[model samples]
Target chain A: MPLSRVRIVLIATSHPGNIGAAARAMKNMCLDKLVLVRPRLFPHEGATARASGAGELLENARCVDSLEEAVTGCRLVIGASARLRTITWPLMTPRETAQKVVSHYDETDVALVFGREHSGLTNEELDLCHYLVNIPTNPDFSSLNLAMAVQLLAYEVLLASEEVTPASQQGQLPAEVEKFEGFVQHLEQTLTDIDFSDPRKSDKLIRKLRRFFMRAAPDDEELNLLRGILSAAQGRKSMRRDETSKE
Target chain B: MPLSRVRIVLIATSHPGNIGAAARAMKNMCLDKLVLVRPRLFPHEGATARASGAGELLENARCVDSLEEAVTGCRLVIGASARLRTITWPLMTPRETAQKVVSHYDETDVALVFGREHSGLTNEELDLCHYLVNIPTNPDFSSLNLAMAVQLLAYEVLLASEEVTPASQQGQLPAEVEKFEGFVQHLEQTLTDIDFSDPRKSDKLIRKLRRFFMRAAPDDEELNLLRGILSAAQGRKSMRRDETSKE
Candidate 1:
């Protein structure tokens, strides 16, 4: 089976539109399968409406009751939670998660499970899975929407897959989330290193750049290319400075 | 000039209660630096009550007027939003926003700016930020309390700072998301393709299943793993079905 064999399951969804949106997210990554556990509202126009253009996925979804039945034959169960619990399996970042799940493709069934809207997967439900996956989020605000989480992971999967390459440009691009973030972090370090973080601006130096790049929203691939260029230029400049000083 | 330099700023916040709560969230994530920009009513009884003993955050809270004063020297300004398009800067979801801010922490002071309760950061106020941060929410109802959003992003920054992940465990489980989600999705498709819909139980089946997975909440890495395995199973099942059809 190909990656298409995977399933994305949602439990106790309260909003119908979320189901549709989740379908859209999955489809955006070419994932078609969607399962709903217990929803407060479903088969509602509101939900389908929210699904936007992803109606096909919504129409082709599966509805289940118990968590057990939803994943009866699932050899691997991966749960989502923001909490760090006393009793549970090992947790992996999304990137690691992709590798582990793909590793199990030949051996058994697998399930990507999520909990409700207001509250996330409880400790009890997490026990079903051999592993847990946590999105690297701000601890101050860690609640991610069901569909958004699916979209984030789905995007990561595509990145990790054979189809993935640095988003093509003349040079390598920092398109991956973590990879791009690394550059941003590195750039910040460079600014601090150079003492160019204009203090008169009251942190305005970095804040403006955050706004600029965020608005610019460089794709990971593009970011890498740019950063590489930047460092190269900086490296040359620094070498010249060193030579001049020696003279 | 590490992430320690990044400051979370709340501006013209109307609710004293939310202010206290926000402090708690930041503290939990190990972020102490907070700046209040033109709070409507601060040092109020409500703020202290809601703070739940996180008085240090409030006591040490820097109170300033005008967004200009709050973010004067801050190099990076990230504004949180749910609605689209009114601000000058391009928008980013909370996750991306967090990463963007984190990247700039070393370069200059980064401000995680939040707006008023009545309407959120105004166009003018939001214009202060270089980038707008949107938390992915149900399109129908994407509103998240200010404190919750703070908690999530703060958590991510802490993770970013630590860099080192603990040995894999339930708290940080390594899931196989792709396979599990794929299985759940395939199972749903099978039921649909096979016409297993019990009219009365259709909703029940879907909802419960979704909730179950929600509880499972698989991460990015695991999803790819599950998808590979699931598509495999579905591929085999389809092949069998095709052979039977030929007969």
Candidate 2:
């Protein structure tokens, strides 16, 4: 819900589909507020069709004639730029911008302003911004689609928001050390039974396998599954031994 | 360039414009390899117009009949999924996936696969992937445009690729996809032969095993060791069968 305080402002956008796509991208990232300044077209079918399930955002978007009007209530304004300007401005990467927005979300409303698809924000439009955010791209082909740019920034914001939240560690808990060691022992025993390794000379091989599985950091369930497979392999070897003894 | 080793694959894309936009997005991120699997429309004007300055990518894009053909020669295969599946697979965030790709760039060819625009990837298609990458989105409105998804992922890859240094490259190279598949098949046969699993009912178990091994990311030498163990296990089973027949 912290993203509610952040507003996405598009300046003089030419393509209606870009506007719709931007709205969809914003909604996907949990940011809702949208302001269009001097859009060439709005309420067009192209926009509606492209918005998909995010039509509500376009319906609730505010239209303003000037950049100042669009960002009037914002305490912090960040301008998105693809080009490295000659003029001195506090430049930030998308991740830095997201961090700034997240840290300031409780204190103030933030505005992230994007520019025209072809020309981008003019000097006067950029002067109103406290910082300029640039998405790094290949130097030769630096042109990113307007909506795609929105998607990238919004994604960074979403990730940043999750990091700051208390419940960010949602992944499964890793297995305890004892349980993991047991699995390693089982693996080593199975390897020996299958004649894949000799107990005296298999230390290096076991160590390598240990390092790899340690990096994977399997959870309890994964560890149990692994132990089951080792048992199955061992079970096969014992069954073979019984048949040979009977012979 | 490390990114040159990364391929962007789109399967059964519906919109031509999305294809063009995806090409542009890839070019912007310095990734050029593109393979399309059964796109609904290609060589269309909509895609050409959307590609803008990146028309060359669209022109050079390889069109294939299936995902297998599209991902041929890749060592690592990562599938992008919007919906969280009931069956557990090793899931990675876009940033983590990007780091993985960049780290493995020196050792292997990587493929990032995206599925249909409306339905996304099928479970069977996902079975072929080593990992599932979920782009975090608002739970209520999780819909993300195909091109926009491609853009965000490519953006993250570009950033991660820039952060990696040559000295960071360590560890053994992973086995090729074909070899990995062969090993999986061998393990399945061994499991059946050992009477531990029935081929008809072991899909879920095999998938779990696949997920675990994929997370461990075994290299050629490690995979060879694993396959050797499977062969040894199968040898015991076949020997037991022969002894029983003689009795």
Candidate 3:
């Protein structure tokens, strides 16, 4: 519900595909509100094709003639800019901006604005924004795709929201220490049965193996499977010895 | 330099524009190594047009025939998956995977593999990966664009690389995928020799074992030790067979 308070606004977008892609990106991060200001083309086949499963977002999007009109009801305005302007404005990274939006979700209707594909936001358009959000990039090549910028910011917002919520713990329970030690003992015996190491000199190798497996933190099922493999391997040698004695 | 060591591998990508867009995203993040495995089309105008200023990466991209070849010589492989698989690989969020790669930057050449646009990586391809990374999305509509996935991951890698200090070295270098595969092959043969499971029906068990070991992520030395043990076990059985033949 906090994410729903954050709206994504695109100003004078040239590519319809970017608009659709942005919509899909927004939906992927659970943000549905979209405002487009004088986009060069909308309701085009390219936009629909790129929207994939998010065509409904496109159909529900509000279109306006100007940035001012787009942010009419928004309580907070943040502009996404690629480069710093001569007149400095408060700039925050995407993560910082996401935190700001989520923390202020209850009190504010937030509008996160993006600009055109080529020139980005104009000085006048940026002036309307209370703060600027910049996604860090290599100085030499900062041409981030329009939709990608949306994806990154939306992703950060989703992460921030999730952080506020209690996380669900999944995955199997780890193997008990005693059981782990039993597996280790079985592994050592199997190594000796195969003559891979003399028991006295194999301490370091066994320790290294132990350390490696310890990093994995295998669960009970995995440990049992490992023990079974060791048993099968050791059983083969014993069976072979029995046959040789019979001969 | 650490970021340079991170390679983005796209498997069976269908669109050239996505490839181009991915290159631009990587360049923006200061990552340039691009490996394409069985792409539908390359060097196309759509890709170049989409690449914008980062066309040089596309021109210099490495095209490979298989995923194995794509990840050759890499010390770590992480697959990007949209949904959780039935047999869960070690799952990490993009940020966590980025942290792992950056912390291990000194000793590891990392490969981040993205699967096809529609269906993600096959279980076989995933078996080759040490970890699976999922970009958290809205479950109702989790359709993430291919290049957008690349952008999100590359962005995280860039952020993590920037956070790396001079003294962040953390673990032993993981074994190269090629050598890891060799150990797995040797392991399968050893299992058959030991009569642990019929070769024809051991697929699921082998996958389970592979998943367990892949989670451990042994280094080159540890991998060699595993192979040595397998060989020792096989050698003992061969010796018994030879004695029986002589008799």
Candidate 4:
């Protein structure tokens, strides 16, 4: 649903092919809203050729002269930036930005504004955005292409919207904490009685073993089975103690 | 580590701008390997301009005549496409494809092959790929730009290699099942002694409880505490039964 409201805004694009490519990238991610601010060329053969079959997107793309005009009604504006500027803005990774966009896209319009081919968005242009999304790149050669940046951002947004269900959420409910605690107390007493664990120095061992079982997260059957073993051990230890006393 | 061994191969690229853009995208994602197959133009002004400051990538780009030549030594080859062809090939989403690339990258050369702008890879070209990578796009307008596709795939690979640490793996080893089972049996016996559960009909409830506890998966101390409660409950029930008999 957010896919329909999300817009791709290109600012002062120098090459016509980039505009075409940007549109194509949007279309690939199921994002069709496009706004171009002060593009040097539009409705060109090179753009058409590069767009391949997605020329319709370029045809419908809105061309505006100013960034202000480009984002008139948008509630959220995100600027894609490659540089670490002197005046630091709230910086977010592309993944984080995508999450924000996906969450707010359905309720309000969202704009992902990109800058020119050579120099990126000016400081003034950056100020217009609520956050600057940085695509982590190789520090030695961090030269990301304009269309490619759009593609990465758009791809992430699409992924977020798809809402891939997490493995944990799939129907299995865990036991209550109180019940599990009861089982542990008996086990420890049994261990101490059996001389498997010394109460005075078993703190470290208990912590490590606790960590181990906590990670495993056994269910009721599993937990019950474990408790049964501990009880049996305790019963056996008590019998042994009685026999020793008699002897 | 696979980042160094991965190669991006573009087959018969007609537009120099795309090549430049692809190079820039590669640089931004920390991927440096580039292979061009019989491009129409190389060392062109358009590509240099589009590459922005990433001209160094273009300068060192490899140009070969044939696809086979381009991917001569690569151990793994992946083809990018938006279409589902007649002969069905094992298709993976960009994320899945990226995971494969990252995993195999360290041990062998991995080639991500992109076809010409107009018509993507040929059937013959696709035959060379172990799997075809598809970016999930809007079915209505699935027109993704070549460089943009490259960028999305590259971004995913970079993310996978970053290796976000899973919480479970950080610490806390899981408890063994056999230990956990012993506790369950003891608890069951105590419940039966206290008349909390009918031995024959309680199987269903016991199974459900087992599942519940299994999901919760308490720590070592938790298990011990639970067993102690069961032992106490059993003792109290036996005392009550003896009192009732005497009365």
**Residues A220-245, model 3: lDDT tens digits:** 88887777677677764333122432
* Candidate 1 structure quality by residue, lDDT tens digits, A58-137: 78778887675676656456777666655435567876766655555555455788889778775445434545787765
Model 3: residues >4 Å from true position, as ranges? A164-170, A236-247, B236-247
Q: Write the per-residue lDDT of candidate 3 for residues B1-247, one digit (tens) a residue.
A: 4277899999999999899899998999999999999999987998999898998899889999999998988888999988876664678889888888888777768899999998989988998898888888898988799999999999998998888553656567778988888888889998888766668988988898888888888888888778877877775433212233211
The DockQ figures for the candidates are 0.06, 0.44, 0.47, 0.16
Q: Alpha carbon lDDT of residue B72, candidate 3?
A: 88
Over the stretch B178-226, how does candidate 1's per-residue lDDT look in tens digits? Answer: 6565656764663343233334445656554544344445544434433
lDDT of each: 0.61, 0.85, 0.85, 0.72
Model 4 vs truth, CA RMSD: 16.9
Q: Please report the TM-score between candidate 2 and the true structure.
A: 0.87
Tell me the lDDT of model 2 at A32: 96
lDDT of model 1, residue B227: 37
* Colliding residue pairs in candidate 2: none
Chain B TM-scores of the candidates: 0.64, 0.87, 0.91, 0.65
Every model: Cα RMSD to truth? 25.0, 4.6, 4.0, 16.9
Write one digit per residue (lDDT tens) for candidate 4, span A1-247: 3276888999988878778777777777778889999888887887777676677888888988888888888889999988777777899998899899989876898999999878999878987899999888877766576777888898888878876723111223335687677776776676566545557876765665555456445556556756654554455322212233211
C-alpha positional error of residue B32 in candidate 4 after TM-score superposition, expressed in Å? 2.0
Count clashes in each candidate, considering only residues at least 3 apart in sequence or on different chains: 130, 0, 0, 52
